[model samples]
Target chain A: MDIPSHITIKEVGPRDGLQNEKVILSTKEKIAWINRLSQTGLSYIEVTSFVPAKWIPALADALEVASTIERKKGVTYAALVPNIYGLERALQANIDEINVFVSSSETHNKRNVNKSISDTLDVIKEVADQSLFTGRKVRGYVSTIFGCPYEGKINLDKIKKIIDSLLNMGIYEISLGDTIGIANPLQVEHTLEELKKSFPLSIFAMHFHNTYGRGLANILVSLQQGITTYDSSFGGLGGCPYAAGASGNVATNDLVNMLHTMHVQTGIDERALTLARRIIDDKLGKRFSSHLLQIKNEQVKK
Target chain B: MDIPSHITIKEVGPRDGLQNEKVILSTKEKIAWINRLSQTGLSYIEVTSFVPAKWIPALADALEVASTIERKKGVTYAALVPNIYGLERALQANIDEINVFVSSSETHNKRNVNKSISDTLDVIKEVADQSLFTGRKVRGYVSTIFGCPYEGKINLDKIKKIIDSLLNMGIYEISLGDTIGIANPLQVEHTLEELKKSFPLSIFAMHFHNTYGRGLANILVSLQQGITTYDSSFGGLGGCPYAAGASGNVATNDLVNMLHTMHVQTGIDERALTLARRIIDDKLGKRFSSHLLQIKNEQVKK
Candidate 1:
């Protein structure tokens, strides 16, 4: 029952959401969407990923997207950078923050980045060093933190080691991802309790997918555990390519609606977020995984 | 988190689910589906409603459905009975339990039953008297306990009064319903805290809609408040006819999945439940509001 008065919501629709979508929006479209999100009072947005186009063709225009969007005064525009090469592109785009990712599961990390966990960390170390030297903050993402598609249950000791490495590398915050959306509230409470024993709870962020519809419940337990920051996509737009049967990230619209209803402020306007969702819905021409968006669609039809 | 080790799940798919669905299953289909559910280890199943066919044509075969379904040992087959007339029909069908419903919001009650709250309660009192005289247990449903469509925020005092009246009328347990699916965890905690002051928490059940995707989160908070019983539908069927934008009831599949993962036993078999869902899906031939079913569908497509 002890909930925070305010929460930090990191908008990841432009980057993670678009990357997994089948339809690739044009550079102009991406910029317009991000610009719309900027005006919604969101203080942080992961705009694009600087991965090679060959890896993620959907976000191929990352540099253009990061460079052209209208940046709000307090909003930190971040882009995911895999290594020094991607970091160079992000720096050239004048990104406000840098993000690096590695999977806690070995098989998932290899499938995601075509490298071992240690190798991925070695590369991230260089990226983090350069991004810090350039006066840009860095955030880390640990995917498959809850469970892995290939590996059933992950070893908590391995997750602790990966988090330790990311924190030591100057990554201010680590977003723990339920890549396949298989986390439950009991597991969330137990995991957070263990993680808090080693690190400050503030450095942890929850990135849940609504695949099995337990995302909000897990987030509720996270709130009770005193973790505040959350990463979500507008219209519930992202999924893990490596994980079959996985749905999209927890929709920002649904997350914000629940948070605001609980009197926990996210500083995001619901109507403005709906405007941004409309753009994505128009381009996709499909139903989203978001409950709020689906309900609104039903209302419009009526 | 003080979660209970065992919980009771009341499956209301056959009655509430089909009542809101556009497709109407034949008596044979309903019997077959309910038979499948009886095999799923679920102890309580609201098989059908005895209201007039003119009102809910989708479940017009309530008499045959309640009579024909295979009654497994340890299963309580229940049906909704609005008044003495419906109670007579349910009694003729030999239903194990009777359920009566009234909305907390006067407008919703008028719209739903063409009667005021007090008049509806009077009708329920008569039905409860008849059912109890016949050696049958009766359960009460208080709709729009969280919020109402026409009345906006319903007064909590009105809800407490309705619950008080139902309990006084020999209703064994009262199910508090979020008719519009607009409830949040904080609101759930606050409301449950207030209700517990006047009644034992064991006498209350949580019936939530997944309209805003806050169903499971609300259930989580209810668990923390020591409320053990929940009402859900297979494949997430049922929406409020009076609420314009409300979605279906929380999917029993999703609810059981989370409960089983949390080690809270529900005495239900997941695979057996999927068999029941398959029958509904085939008869309806449309997508359901269940997260687990949707993910399974994607896997089938793959």
Candidate 2:
């Protein structure tokens, strides 16, 4: 199978990861971690989410984190914005890139955002247009594209419509998320095959979860499908708390390790990434999931 | 990439999984677990090892386990034998299949078995001859085929030589083991491409560890190479105790889940395998390393 020569990794640890974690990091702690992550040579770092404090108190200081971090020269410090208000907050904070998400499955869209798919699309259209018009890159996330907890087996037609809407709204890239980690390689291949025919490969990214231990396998197939951008979290942190069996996003460490070994350049510094992982994982007072990180740390102790 | 329509999984949990574990299951516990596994529809199960008690105190009751479990009609109960003495014990217990192992790297071979590769080969030649003459199948395992703890990269020439020697000595099949789990897809593809030039794919199996979290990805590539047989431990148990950072073997649960999703049949019952996993993992008083098994169990609890 043909694979990409190099891949871009968008690290979502600070935002997607911390939001699901029960242990809340203070503004200072989040800034420290994001700054450390910036030095890891990651091109994109999703710093925080600009959601309302009551909804996600964990990232209540998103504006502070966006303003505090000493952003690196080549890194794009990004933030998640749920609506026009969130996008306005991100703009004030001078976020490098703005991310907006909607679920492809109608049931998930209603459950997650309290809106219908069409309603969510309208909000995304406003958010995407404003972000792009303000000279900021807009990345769209289509959650539950593979399967849904509330509604299993998402249809391909839904994915295509969502992608077309996001692209027409000027979203620079769309991340197809396996929200519940219910995807298998065959399902992933089939989905990508259909999606690729409908969209340019340059505007696609894969966001997978390790909920079923199929994260890397899915990524491997995505690589063969000529996908060059992937969304991941450091130490594999971030999973929906409501999703009973779901784990974190595919660990950034594991993804980079596999890519490097396969001769696919990711331009990530392993040592710096581990240091950032240690800082956050230690602060959380728990071992975050990431097999490569865990094993390497264990060896160091030995 | 064409995948095989069906695959054979040789469950190595009882022997390899328990051997490396710190917790010791009593003879009765082992028998109970083995009996549960027999009903899982696995065509082959490596029950226990007949090595010296000092070498593996965990499997000291290998003879009793081999004799006690009510072996199912379709499953072949297998055992690991380190030398002629272990082979004799296996013979007395009427083990259906015998497994012998050596390392592709000389340092690892010496460290693992305290014998040179040539000397190990001589012993394996004897064991294979006797087992075949007695109408039993012999499976040879070439450990550290991809990477070694003491020696990082192993030569492909060494792998070819070992396979040739085993085949000539009447070994029915040879398993290429990534003992330290340092395999990548490109390297696996390259190694398999070179080896297949001299050997038939029918006599080969892939045994991978999840040390680097690349187990399933490696397995995916191997499946595409037409390898139908794989060795895995349930709950992802079994790692080299001597290798400092080695994790468990690829979990049988994860392997079957991936294979079945890819439309490849393994003829194993997921529910039954999970039942067997619960029995052994609860007895060990720790969650074993299979991500899929752990997540499912956690969901059931919720």
What is every candidate's alpha-carbon RMSD to the true fold?
Answer: 1.4, 1.4
- Tens-digit lDDT track of model 1 for A143-188: 9988998997899999999999999999999999998899999999
lDDT for model 2, please: 0.86
What tens-digit string does per-residue lDDT give for candidate 2 at A26-136? 898888888898898899999999989988999888888898899799999889999999998998999999999999989888978899989998998889888888888
Give all candidates' CA lDDT scores: 0.89, 0.86
i-RMSD of model 2 (Å, 1 decimal): 2.1
In angstroms, the error of model 2 at A58 is 1.4
DockQ of 2: 0.64
Please identify model 1 stretches exceeding 4 Å from their true place. A242-245, B242-246
Residue A180 of model 2, lDDT score: 81
Question: Alpha-carbon error at A165 in model 2, in Å?
Answer: 0.8
Give residue A27's lDDT in candidate 1 (0 to 100). 89
Q: What TM-score would you report for chain A in candidate 1? A: 0.97
lDDT of 2 by residue, B213-241 (tens): 88898998888889999999988887666
Q: In candidate 1, how many Å is residue A145 off?
A: 1.2
DockQ, all models: 0.69, 0.64
lDDT of 1 by residue, B22-110 (tens): 77888988898899999999999999999999999888888888988888999999999988899988999999999999999999899
